[model samples]
Target: MTLDIGTQHRDASVSGPSSDLSPSPPSSPGLVSTHAAAVSPAPARKPTTASNAASTSAILSWSDEKVKSCSSLRARKDLRRNLEVDVLQNIQKALRTSPNPFFNDPGAAAQEALRQAQIYKAWIQDQEGSSLEVAIVNDHPQGPADGCPPYDFVWVNGYVHDDTIPPSDPSELQGCDCEDDACNPATCKCFQKAVRFDTLNIYKESKQFAYNADGTLQDMMVPTYPIFECNSKCGCSSACTNRVVQKGRRVEIEFFKHQHYGWGVRARHRIKRHTFIGIYSGELVSDAEADRRAIVYEDVGSTYHFTIDPHPIKLETMRKRLASSPEGRTMTEEQLMQRVNDWTRLMDLYQAHREHKVTAKQLKEFNDRQIVEAKRKGEWSRRWQAELEAELAEWEARYREEPDNYLSLEPEDQARAEDLSLFYEDQQEANELTVDGALHGNFTRFFNHSCDPNLATWPVWIEEGSIWRPFFCFFALRNIEAGDELNFSYTSAEEVDDMVKRLNQIQVEQGTKPGTKRMKCLCGASNCRGFVFG
Candidate 1:
């Protein structure tokens, strides 16, 4: 399924952190995904232009003649950095705790949040030249009234990866060898990756590169398949048309303080439909850390938490796991007939039973008479079983001594391995990750909630040979006017982002309304779904 915020009016445009807003540092080249059919293969790339068209309005209030200022000071670099980077690290080490902290008491947590906020405000001011984007405009009468902690987070425009998920080895990645130094949509291996999901060749629904020739997204792509962009590994140049999200922020965006809805992002210019906005970036934590933080964020309005579990269990995932299973090997009679020559063909079955190999249903296939006859020659059967045990023991020893040689079973064992593959499957939960943007994140985290939003989220893979771990990307659902608050639905009916649809469906089946204490939404759309139950 395709993956799929709010507020009041009347603000004279004000500047707060506008000067500090700067373009993010580019990702190291040669990182990126490939075809789904292949368990392993290669990488994906792109650049951009989002013109901030003049704001549309009849009022002069949008213009700023006076020096725009914020009463709330910028965070102190030393104190705030110590709190988030050093002190927090020391505390975590001392307590031997995880990245997330659980106060258990809301009152104490709120107090600690304020203390940290003070330090952060000064740090931001001190590090005005620090590479962070997204302007923060504080127009509230009382400095900063909203936010569990008023600030969004330390700006992280891209994912921060560590040793939680599987490593992506550069040597294993494959890139498209485009002709004439350019990618042809018809043959570009990167674009062809979409064939497993949807393809232009099928013609039922156009699943071509989402962008038009002009770089704006084609409208039909709103609910389209996951995007696979051309990357540095590809022979194609940076100008490749398939590249969009990799181009980074194409439109101007900022954090605007809304009295009722807290901090929210608004467009700085006219954003054409399908324009790449920003990424939902943060520290990539394992599933366990995400779960711990989810509980701690009970009192917060929005949990800046996004789980990367979009890829369902693929057949290859199951096949590989089964091939690596202990019971996936077998022996054949042709090789063992020397000992079972006088014995019946059932000797193969008897040996397999002794080794406890493969499935039981295969053993049950034998007729009662065949088994009785095989057992009637108990002396011969014992000799055959001993030879089978000795051979298996030798093979096991060799496999242990030389794992590389035993990676694949012998040709005679292929049939049994196929049967074992059918009986095995595994969940990709271990491959899952969650991005927590509550404390340190790009402007995207400040997007307000909306029922009918202008933006939609989808998984994008740019790190080749790493399709399983996709980047959380946001795209414009429609043309957005400059200065409008950027919004995206917190929950989607499709199993894209949150589980609100499934949760609501369960409530209907059980005849219950949403939990009474659910976070109320301020989008104020006519079709507003009432609460943020995701």
Candidate 2:
């Protein structure tokens, strides 16, 4: 699925650090901080663009009274901390002190649990608002019945909500068209509301938010979150968008936009290696169902494995099987096994016939066979014989190098292989079809095909419960600047920059001069790796 949050409207003047926003001294680039803009001097002029009208509104409203209010806000650091602590404490009480009794019991424990949940929910709202006045609306069972219902409880920045619900069209967050004193809703319809829910949402969704059996909160959780978005949505008011979902104690996937076709995602925020973005959800099929769908394959080792098609399989038969029954009752395990046996036997028979035919021709060759007809036959036989010998040699080498790679196992082992392969195949199929399952749902997908990339992808696995949960993270292997199309090496595992040298080795073997290895990169980083590594 693709999430195209076109035209994210950050104040160009208010981004980054306070120092960065100010004009820099002759010796260095300017540094600015969005957070520290509180004390900065007012600009001589105002931003007049429609997109910037919101900032201008805030600026125009700024007065000595407001400045005093800002000072009061700056002084209230402990309030934020207290809100966070209250959330933590409530979560701890829910896990430890609360009893898991039936709702029939209206005891103190159950009441207490409800109370704690309300408190925690309240904390979520405070986090969303940063101040207490604004409220984040979570789905309350009776709201828009079709969309993601629960809004962040907190009202911090980065919070998103559909202002127009069931009775209205999805609102396209728009800009303020103020130029020439005009209010053009066509050009400036900022509809979807977003508040800063990133830090709080990440906090709540992270494993750190989970309570221990004794009802204590984990103290080691990091509160910062990476959230970014584009500046505009181009013309399409309805394009796909994505979010990082936190499930249970561990952050797995919150599904991206499940509706829409050809959806893809790019990072609004810079994500680091090993971050758990999300998961693939689909119909889980049994081995028999997989075989009936024609997704089964037998390898050289005679190991049966299932594979979902590398591409979407549009076959009507497969579609019927998936649609007809939840458990796929149409094909039985016995029938699937019978089909597998028949297919394997037929394949073996064909192999034997070909081998015998080639062997017979090879044995007919003789030194005295020099007649025109004989020579022609001999040449043909020799070619087949040579091919057969090469195959035999390859098999022999494989057998000697890794004899155990092939398995000769009992019926149960075969069944296990069939089951394992089917599960894998099913997952692959879901990945291709599911909106958020595609790897392209993140910025890492656009990373150009470079033998050596300036970016690198790393797999993150949080080991727990005898399972290693896997997620992918991307990092800048080399410094990147704004506006540079990010690039990463095509080869997996190696960082992009390292892949460059590896590519040179291949080029060297092919006897080509990999000339002028470095060029100024378009990425506006101060420390860009000068060379492009495709």
Candidate maximizing TM-score: 1
Q: Return the top candidate by lDDT.
A: 1
Where does candidate 1 stray beyond 4 Å?
Answer: 1-135, 144-152, 179-181, 199-207, 299-302, 311-425, 493-517
For model 2, give the 10-residue run with minimal summed lDDT: 295-304
TM-score of each prediction: 0.54, 0.22
Clashes of each: 27, 56
Report the C-alpha lDDT of model 1 over 144-164, residue by residue, as the tens digit: 121112332444456554334
| Candidate 1 overall lDDT versus native | 0.44
Which regions of candidate 2 fall more than 4 Å away from where they truly are?
1-400, 405-411, 423-446, 454-485, 493-534
Residue 291, candidate 2: alpha-carbon lDDT: 30
Candidate 2, overall lDDT? 0.25
